[model samples]
Target: MRREFKLPDVGEGLTEAEIVRWLVKPGDQVKVKQNVVEIETAKSIVELPIPWDGVVAALMADEGQTVDVGLPIIAVDTAEPGVPAGGAAGTAVGTAAGAAPGEAIKALADDMVPRPPAEGAVEPGAHGSPAPKEERQAVLVGYGVKTGATKRRPRKAPAPPAAAPAAPAIPAAPVANPSRVEVTAHPVPARVAVLAKPPVRKLAKDLGVDLAAVTGTGPEGSITREDVRAAAEIVAQPEPRPARVAAPAGAEERVPVKGVRRMTAQAMVGSAFTAPHVTEFLQVDVTETMNAVARLRAMPDFADVKVSPLLLVARAVVTAARRHPMINSSWDEEAQEIVVKHYVNLGIAAATPRGLVVPNVKNAHELSLPELARSLGELAETARAGRTQPAEMAGGTITITNVGVFGVDAGTPILNPGEAAILAFGQVRDMPWVVGGELAVRKVTTLALSFDHRIVDGELGSLFLRDVGAMLEDPLRMLAWS
Candidate 1:
């Protein structure tokens, strides 16, 4: 018995993923929980395994196709048919996440027919011209499409054989007699004939437009959409953007959407739309934090780790979140509940080719300052190196994005979806400050915190921001408060 597998929604809010590659093709034997393909999600590459052991029967979807979650990509011939049809196999096949979605995503497959050696190049798949129906295989099972109306789909046709193709043209009867009297027979097309290629002719026929009667603007006086849509119901399509680099005359190029690039695009779009975000900014005098960082560099325990302004800011945000637990939660719309987390899985936002991924350090509150600095270094390295895995990027409780590394002061930021708040840390620079009634240099930085308005109210938001700022302004406050 063959069971088709559709792409599953691997995460809570994902709608789609790009299939990067197929590890197994038709006729290969696979085992349950053995990888069949790798799918690239927005943040990481995940390998999808076969749900049951069987011979690989069919693969639907071509490589590089972007499919909506729950669409099938492959079919597994699970043992024998009398076994009650994989009765225990259920829907668990669609929900597991373990491998990176890789190179080419699965899409509709193309089957081949026996061809003579003299024929030219064959097209890749089903999207190509139609061949004889009998040459095709049994319908593919894993794609999300239901088994209905596939007969309506047209396959591109092979060109007619040259030896027996040409037909005699039928001549139209004369429209005017020799006496100059109008003797109508079959009406002649308008004096200016609409000259168009076969595709344009097909378009005109489908739209119920007469090529003979419409005005032509195309070269060779061909009629177009403005000539068609203006004449009928046909709408012109916008041309796609040109490729960045021109392809070599006949070389095929494959784009791999796996790894960091895919992951980043997914996170940005999720962060942008789901949460109703409101970002508030506060500039702080962080002269004390700078001194503390310098003092920490002098310490024996902290000597190895690279210290930056973000190190102190991370500690401050975590300290402040502890003081304000409401800022560390998700707004559950369906349940109508506000979830407050008792533990902190602090997400540090890292920008990579995969976009903005906040792979958090789990149980950050459990780590000491030197430990936190080490975790931050490892997190940055893992992120920059494009090796952060699926589990690390998932389940972030609260997030902090350091836009300061880019040299910008501050701006509004959106909250990562599900999390109640996200903080943006800006660059610390020397600025004028009043100290003991005298103008002096101070280490200054800006803080921007965006929260889900539905979860963190204005008072709570202000207090969270104020405490984080207070801690940064006086690093000693973190020790005192802890």
Candidate 2:
């Protein structure tokens, strides 16, 4: 029963995963249902488990490789009677296509964890044969396999110590292999980098701030987006750059934008170029909404939720989306069809090292205020942790990008590659405004909604903007509208 482990869809709607580390190698015998590898998706780190007891054959994917969901990561051979497992004493897994065990999969990382190898004596460089590559360690991985269907790892018959200067190899005698061998255990769990979202990482890198030195007030010693901004402000007053080494290349060091950077560049360019973006701006007087947010924080309904203007914006968008269903639609070029989604899978564009990932809340309109808040928090946290699964990022109806949090008025927002619309919220500031025909200080902010004109008309677009502004301007209208 040879098996290969396909990358499973982890949580947070992740479509692809990066192989952080491997736990097993080729030719190692493995038991069923063991941990094989630790993968980092757009959301966070996840350990993959094996399905069958087998010897590891080969690893289909390499460490740091981003593989799509349902793709093979490892191959293993189910231990069988005829299959000769390992050749060398330390050699693991006999050769045949199969999955690796989860527990025995820890490989030599910076932490120096040893993982189990793939099965059957891989004929050194040949399939179904034995090869010894002791310098490199490997781990077995299980995709989605069944339980108790795995075979035990069989140690090889030891070669007798160089007898007579290796005259002739002894004919192996059948011996009952040891039932189990103790594997080196992992001392500590992987550190979860709860640093700021993607933009913050970019901001810190651009500003040359040492992320390691900044003390994070966010949960799990993770730096929040605010932390980076604060550090930037303090340092900006004096010397612009942080105290670091001189430019070794002195004005020349054109780093090539490869890997994630290249992909992000191409993605942004394609989105801006293809999407005929019409950005409609709305400057709302959110004074009443701010008061409502403060009061909501005192209420029992919002006890577990974090209240902010963004929450209100989320509510307003959902409400407006209901009235304007086209906001929740997509423009399908291939089928020559317009996808007007009745439901809102609201996506929040997050910046991370892996690039821009807009993980959305599933069916946002159905949830209550507190649930919505909680969901948003969880989504942000998952995205920051890079644990978000491909599934969480897919099926987005519409999106909200918080340019306001960045203290910017508004940006000509680009549409998410597939979605029809994206809303960019600007910073709420106290500015002089005309109130009752008198100049007064008002907490005013801008809302820029960029819609795909192909699906949404000018009339529909204006109405959606006006409705959202009305809700923010006077939240009481939300009750009447509902």
Residue-pair clash count for candidate 2 = 71
TM-score of each: 0.56, 0.60
lDDT of 2 by residue, 395-442 (tens): 889999998777899898888878888899899999999999999999
lDDT of each: 0.71, 0.71
Top TM-score prediction, candidate number: 2
Model 1, range 339-442, lDDT digits (tens) per residue? 99988988998887656677899999889999999999999998887667668877888888888889989978777667989898888888998889999988
lDDT of 1: 0.71
Instruction: State candidate 2's TM-score.
Output: 0.60
TM-score, cand. 1: 0.56
lDDT of 2 at 320: 91
